[model samples]
Structure formats: C-alpha cells, structure tokens
Target: MNPLVITVNVKSTVYCDFQLRWYPWDDPHCFLNLKVTNVPSFGLLVDGTSTVTMRPELLEEYEVVECRLQETPHPTNNLTLLVHLTRRYQYHLWTTFLPTSLLAAIGYGTLLLPLEAFAERGSMSLTTLLMFIALYTETNSSLPSTAYLKHIDVWFVFSLIFLTLVINVHLMTFLADSESAGQSVRPTPSRHLTHVSAPPFAKRVRDRMAVPKRILRMSTVLFALVFIIFTLVYFLAIV
Candidate 1:
C-alpha cells in the first residue's frame, strides 16, 4: 500500500484580548491558532512545517516585532503562532503629546512674566487652560472610554491640575496686592506717633508685596521640578 500525503491551507479571523493600561504606549500580543476539526483526534496531526505569512498591508497601525510558531502542547491539539505587536506611536505623539507639552510650556511661561504683569500672566494662563481643555477633549473623543486611567490620561490630569493651580496662585496674589495697596493708602491714625509711623507702614507694605512675589517664584521652580520628574519616571520606568 502507498502512503497518502496532502497539504492544506487555512485562514480565518480570531479574537484578541488587549491590555490598555498603558495605551498609546502599549504593546499588545496575540496568537493565531490553526486547528484540525471534523475528524477523530487520532486522525489529525500538526507539525513545525506550518508557516505564517502576513501581507504587507495587513497591519497599518502596528508593527510586528516578533513572530514565532509553537507546536501545540499535549493538552491543546492545535498549532499556535505568536505575534507581538508594537503600537506605532508617531500619530499619537504628534496629536496629543506634543500639543499638551506645548500648552504646559506656555502655561508655565506665564510664571516667567514680570511679577508686576499680573493681568498679562492671568490672561495667558486662562488662554492656555482653554487650549488644553480643547485638546484633551479632542484626544479623549478619539479613544473609547475605559474603567482605569491610561498613561496619557495621567499626563492630562497633571497638566490640568498645574494650570488650575497657576490660575489660583495668580488670583491669590492679585487679592493680596489689592488689599496691601488699599491699606498702604489708608493708614490708622495715631496722634503721638503720626510722623514716626510712615516708615513702619512703608515697611509693612513691602513685606506684603514680597509675599506674593515669593509665592510666584516658589511655584515656578516647584512645578518645573515636578514636571521633570514625571517625564523621567514615565519614560524611563513606567513606559
């Protein structure tokens, strides 16, 4: 009797479970299983001779970093091909990361303004905040909502927090300056020490003004350090 040999070709769609905790920075893995069906288990066989070929245009959004075929283990009667997919981040980097970074820079820039330019600084922070809101909305709209926060979501929250704090700082300093100026003009009356009180009142006004200036300087330095640390940890460790 002569032995019979035959070759079969199969292709079909399969389901993949994706982890999106680090989305936009996430690399997901998938497996393709080719199984023999409709025959007794003893009549079917699989071997390393199986091959996986992908069309050039099959994947446009991801790069296949690794592809390996593994013979099915004893428990499972199938051939498994493991495909490691790395997300292409250029599109997201340009649309989201770059824009948020620019907004953060411009928001922080308001702090670099002259301490006396409260109006200009406040206006800039508000404008930057509005721009950031629009960007965050557009970004989130493109992605499906998830239960947990994504890596990029953390970044946006941090930026929004920083901008909100900047605006509050400006408001606090504005109120403090206005109150101090008002007090400087309307000093308390003292019959015995009227002339002698001028220097002390002037000193008091300087101290009050100094407080806001110091707050601005401290906030600028502190926020800058915080942003640097977040970037380093996010890229070097978390990512």
Candidate 2:
C-alpha cells in the first residue's frame, strides 16, 4: 500500500474582546484558540503552521506588535495564537483631546476678561459649553457604554462642569450689577454748585472695580490651579 499526502486550507474569522478603559491608548493582548479533533496526536505530528494575514483594515485601528503560536497541554490538541496590538492614537488625540483642551482653555479665558464683561463672558462660556457637550456626545457614541468611567469620560465630565461653573459665575455677576444699578444713581443735591470737586471718572472706575478685581484674580488663580492639578493627575495615572 502507498502512503497518502493531504493538503488542507482554512479561512477563519476571529472575535477579539478588548478592554476599553484606556480606550484609544489601549494596547491589548488577545489570543485565538484552535482545537484539534478526530485525528490523534501521532497522526497529526509532522506539519508546521504559518500565518499570511495582511492587516490593512486592522492597521487603521491598531498596530500589530507581536504574534506567537504555542500548543496547550490538553486531552484534545489545543493551539493558542497570541497577538499583541497597540491602538493608533493619533485620530483620537487630534479629534478628541486637542479640541476639548482648547475649548476648556477658552472657557477659562473668560475669567480673565474684565470683571464686568458680562456679555462677552456669557457668550464665550456658553459657546464652549455647547461645543464641549457636542464633542462628549459624539465621543461617547463612538464607544460602547461601560459600567465604569473611561479616562476620556473623566476629561469630558469635568470639562463640562467647569464650563457650567463659568456660566454660573457670569450670571451671578450680571445679576449683582443689575440689582446694584437699580438702587444706585440717586441724585445728589446741587453737587454741581458745590466747591468740593468730584473724583475723576477713571478714579471712580478704578475704585468701583477694586473688590471685583480682587475676586476675579482669586478666581483665575483657583481655576488655573484646578486645571493644572487635574491635568497632572490624568497624565500620571493614565499615560
């Protein structure tokens, strides 16, 4: 009797469950398992295996870092293919990180404006708040919802809160000025005829702004420090 030679070809689809806490920066190590059946170990002993995968579509999301093939010790023959992948972070960094950061800075910049710049401050903070919400919605939609907050979620939530706080500060300042104006400007009796000179307009303006100026300066410092500490914690904990 003559010995027989057989050639087999197989194409397969694999499902990888990735851990998404790190999201765009996640580098996941996954595995594929193949179970050999029917043939005994002696009958399947002589051939080597090779992979010829072209990963263009995969490369769009991740870079293939390494792959290893090994046999598991099992009653049924088991082969495990280990694959290590690093996510492509540029897209998220540009679309998500940079824009959100710039928006946050713009929101904080409103605090630096003149203490009575109600309109400009309100407009800028409101616009940035809306934009931040839209970005967070878009980003969240692209990802599967998880029970725990992701690193990106932390940034989005806190940034939204900061913008909201800025708007509240603006609103309070506006209301305070409105109330002050209502009770103010009572006519002084014949100051025009008195010899006592009135303070210059610039000096009055400076005097009126003193308390608000100090409050705004403190706000700017506190807000700036909050942002800096959050940024540092984020990078240290996540990066």
Candidate 3:
C-alpha cells in the first residue's frame, strides 16, 4: 500500500492543519500504535507564532476492524491524525485598519465644515467613501473565500456604515440650510434706523441655523459614541 500523505492550505493566513497516519498488519496479540515524540515547527514562515494543537485519537469501528482482519487474515485498524492551529493577523492593522481609520476620520472632519460649503463637504464625504470602497475591494481580493465573515470583515463593514451615515448627514444638513436660506430671502421693509435694527444678514442667517446646527453637532457626537462603543464590544467579543 502507498504511504499516507496530507496537504493543507494556508490561504487564509489564519490557521493550518496537518494529518499523518499509517496502518500495520499483525496478529491480534500484537498492537500497532503511533505517538508524538516531538513536534517541529513544520517549516512555516512564521514558525513558533501559530498556535497548534492535536485532536483525540479516533479508532475505526469494531465491525470495520473485524472485516479487515477476516478478509486479509491479519489484524488491522484505522486511525485519524488531526491538528488545529490559529494565528493572529497583526499585519492587517497597518495595511488595512490604519487606512480605514484615517478614512473614517476624514469623513468625520466634513461635519465640522460650514453648511454653506455644501460642495466642499459633499466632495469630501464622497471622496472618503470612494477611497474606502477601493481599499475594501483591494483587501478582500487577496483573502480566501469563506462562508463566514472574518474579523477584518466586521471592521470594514462598520467603517463603511459610518461613512455612509456621514454622507447622509451632509445631504440632510445641506437640504435644511438651503430651505432656511430660501425662507430668509424677503424684501427689506422701510423703517426708521435704530441702534437695535435687524442684525446683519450673516448674523440673522446664523441665528436661524441655531437649532439645526445644534442637532448636527449632537449627531456627530452620537455617531462617535456609537462607533467607540461598537469597536469596544467587537474587539472584546473577538478576543
């Protein structure tokens, strides 16, 4: 019979497995067994970094063993060799997480801009979103496909959602400002000039925006708090 061979895939860069097995034909009085005397690093690039553990032995059923014994006129049994491994993806923090965090910061900066600078804020938000999309696409392309999401996946998804909400805030603020500006446009009424005459146009506009501006500021704070809480919970859960 041919020797047993096992191959593993390291595409995930998260974990790997190795299996080794052999069969022995002997009398019932004699036994065949395997043991782990020493485990080398397996020639991995990141040797000693990955966590490795073995599974309990799994023996073949009695029926199968008996059949093999009778058919071959010898004693034989089957066994399994299994191992589990885990690895941390520290590299992604710089390559993926850092850039994503910066993108999120850029999105938040747009909120501080004045509502009158609609074009500037809108462009900033859109640009941040586009750059985030490109970064996400590039990162995912190199990862192996899996049914379940990875830790980095969660990070990217949350970042995208945050950016989308920022963009929405910009849109809503612009609309509110535009509506207020339109309503404020009225013919000046002739009246005796006084020290307390109607405030300058800029001050009047600013006064009208007090509520919306407060609401926008509160929304920014709320977004930040939510993001911080989410990140804490997510990291704790993952760890």
What's every prediction's RMSD, in angstroms? 3.3, 4.8, 14.5
- Whole-model lDDT, candidate 3? 0.63
User: Which residues of candidate 1, in runs, are more than 4 Å off?
Assistant: 1-13, 38-40, 47-49, 53-58, 73-77, 191-197, 200-208
lDDT of each: 0.80, 0.76, 0.63
lDDT of 1 by residue, 121-199 (tens): 9999999999999989988998857899988788889889988888998888888788777776776776776455356
How high a TM-score does candidate 3 get?
0.61
Query: For model 2, how big is the CA root-mean-square deviation?
Result: 4.8
Q: Comparing 2 and 3 by lDDT, which wins?
A: 2
- Best candidate (score: TM-score): 1
Q: Indicate the TM-score of model 2.
A: 0.77
Candidate No. with top lDDT: 1
> What lDDT does model 1 reach?
0.80
